[model samples]
Target: MKCIERIKYPEFDFKEYKASEGRHSVHDYPAMLHYLLVNHLIKNYSSENSLIYDPFCGSGVSIVESLKLNRKAFGTDINPLALLIADVRASNFETDRIRDVLDRFNIEWNNLTPDIPEVKNISYWFKDYVIKDLGKIRTFLRTVKDNEIFKFLLVVFSQTVRDVSNNRKGEFKRYRLSEEKLKQFTPNVRKTFISLVEKYLKIVETDIIPFTDFKLFLQDVRVSIPIKNVDLIITSPPYGDSKTTVAYGQFSSFSFDWLKGLNPYGDGDLKLDSLCLGGKKIKEQKELPSGHLYDALKNIEKIDEKRALEVYSFFYDYYLSIKQVVKTLNDNANVCFVVGNRTVKGIRIEMDFITAEFFESFGLTLENIFVREIANKRMPLKNSPSNITGKTSNTMLNEYIVIMRN
Candidate 1:
């Protein structure tokens, strides 16, 4: 089947796609679109036993979809929190064992005292009581024996932190909630944890797949995969520099705080460009005809002369790393990358085209580009217009899925 022919599901609709049932339904991203894309790739280019891979498997959407369709799946991400999530979501757990562990955790969690003695960033976003309750749940998970069950519960707890905290209903900027709003819905931490766990258990029971093989990696995608040549690749690489697009680490810092051993601010983690206001190096870099972004010290009137050179050097080096991975693909194998364009310094950076150009150097031909609208993704703050580019729409309505073949 041709790519377009395979994707032509009679039931597909953008509004209904947003409301479709599955993991992506609760979170952001169109699950139907991903499902359609995955199905198309598998049917046209992959066998049932083909090794499917997602380099930026955020929350393991592709991995889960692959298993649901009975394919071998592998995924990688730089965020430890994301890695943990991907691990649990894609794992084929024994239902009975998962239920037993969750029940035990709940029992022990209730008996423990809600006292988080050493807090980090808790005071800034959560009330004292909420923090105490959250700490108690974390304390119990620390003692759980089954690593799979423990990690699954950890994601559930982490997911709830945003809702129970002072920042539940605010726009996707930083965690800035009013005191009155915080008091309105002071979610009992223990109660919320139990509810989330129950929901997860119910989902697992209903949707668990018993015979799928999956692996999760906490590493940058620019490196080589430990496995031999893969049969297929489907991923959405980070848009622009990590610093400028979104502060994924900062967004999920609260959960990382609870997962004590995990490092949210580790060295290899990408530093956000929004927070960098003014430094010398931001001025000197050459602006790509296609508005590729770079991390520079914020608040400079123009790009810093010295810093621009350094930032460009860093970007090219990263691109070379991605190039190495592309070169490792099996002959005639197919790769699909979900990416989008962005504006930098009031210029449109056609990332899709630039990425096509990059991959072509490795003998991969651009087959097709499909545009999907991501209307639900978090947008820029209303009051804060982008300093470099003045446009202020928050929704990422325009997206591109670039297909390539060796």
Candidate 2:
């Protein structure tokens, strides 16, 4: 295959095709890889029926797309909500079963008494009436018999949970609206849930494909390798540590908090960013394989010593995960890492070069690094990495798709 130095996706519209993506469009993920990009990568990287693996499959876009392209897939993530969304997306569902389940759920919602889970400071995020309505929906969901139908119904309700929450919309972090804004906030919780069920039912009907084998594991790739013999790896790992870049854990907290019992692997705590890659700080700094990474750390250190450590810790964990992943890849397998070069304290970290450097250290050949502008990728326009009010830095303008052969 020929390699291109850089690539542009002017024709790929993020919102271009809705029903075609099936369950992928049922929920939104922070910094999600568009369906078009995932589909294109799977088609080019692996043959039909080949095994594909995503180590950091957030919402399972790679898994869904791979199966849609007639390939088997495996996805692993530490985030319970992410795993649930991915699991629901990858599973095959019958439209008739889902409709029947929905019918029973509506009847149960009216009869069942509200069973509100004990979420820490739930009132701050939801009003009294809204809380009761959500509890009623959740209580009824617990009575569901079919596992697939239960998860599918829970996902739809989860969407409604985020939509009707006091948390400000379009922000990944848990920022509550002002008191003035709260006064005007009126959300019809029941209406929202029913409407979402109907909307996603249509998508589920369109996405019903023949049964394809796909597995989702609620395990961290950094600690354990769940599968082997991967022919292709298509994933977009967290660009930076969860706290600074995309707060995936924080973003999913609302829904996870409500559905913690259903999660087989969640720790009951909601600070998921701390458990994600680069979420922890390393006390010792050691030699790294990538010179580009070392130099970036030095540059960041000059600006802020603590900030440099944060960056170093993230990369260190990232390198460890790469090492673990290398052990699982079959010979001549391909890896596509969709990464963003984020600026911290005004120094742009060369993630693309660093990523290439890490893979090369493990005997993988760097094939190509295709740069694409962030036209519609959902991310904050700017962020204060330093946490100072005025110390703002622009987010990534583009992302690099670093393709390598193992």
Q: Considering every candidate listed, which one attains the maximal TM-score?
A: 2
lDDT of 2 by residue, 1-406 (tens): 1334566555544445542355777876777887788888999999998999999998888988998888999988888788888887887677688878778776776687888988889999999999999998878888877888888888887889899999887667788888999999999988899888888888877777554789888877778797999999999988888777777878888988788687544543556889889999999999889988888899989989998999999999999989888887999999999998888888889898898889899999988888766556767544464553222234567778899998
Backbone clashes (count) for model 1:
16
TM-score of each: 0.79, 0.93
lDDT of 1 by residue, 1-406 (tens): 1222113223322434432245543322211235555556566667777778877676777787777777788877666766676666666556678678767776676588664644456677787778878777767766767767766777777777766767645333345676676657667777777677777666766777654798877765555556547778877765644345545655555555566563232322223322211211343445432222432213111644443353454445446545666755777878887765665443455556666666776777878766766643444422222422222365455667777888
lDDT of each: 0.59, 0.82
C-alpha lDDT (0 to 100) for residue 146 of candidate 2: 82
Top model by lDDT, which number? 2
- Clashing residue pairs, candidate 2? none
Go through the candidates in order and give the clash count of each. 16, 0
Query: Against the hidden true structure, what lDDT does model 2 obtain?
Result: 0.82
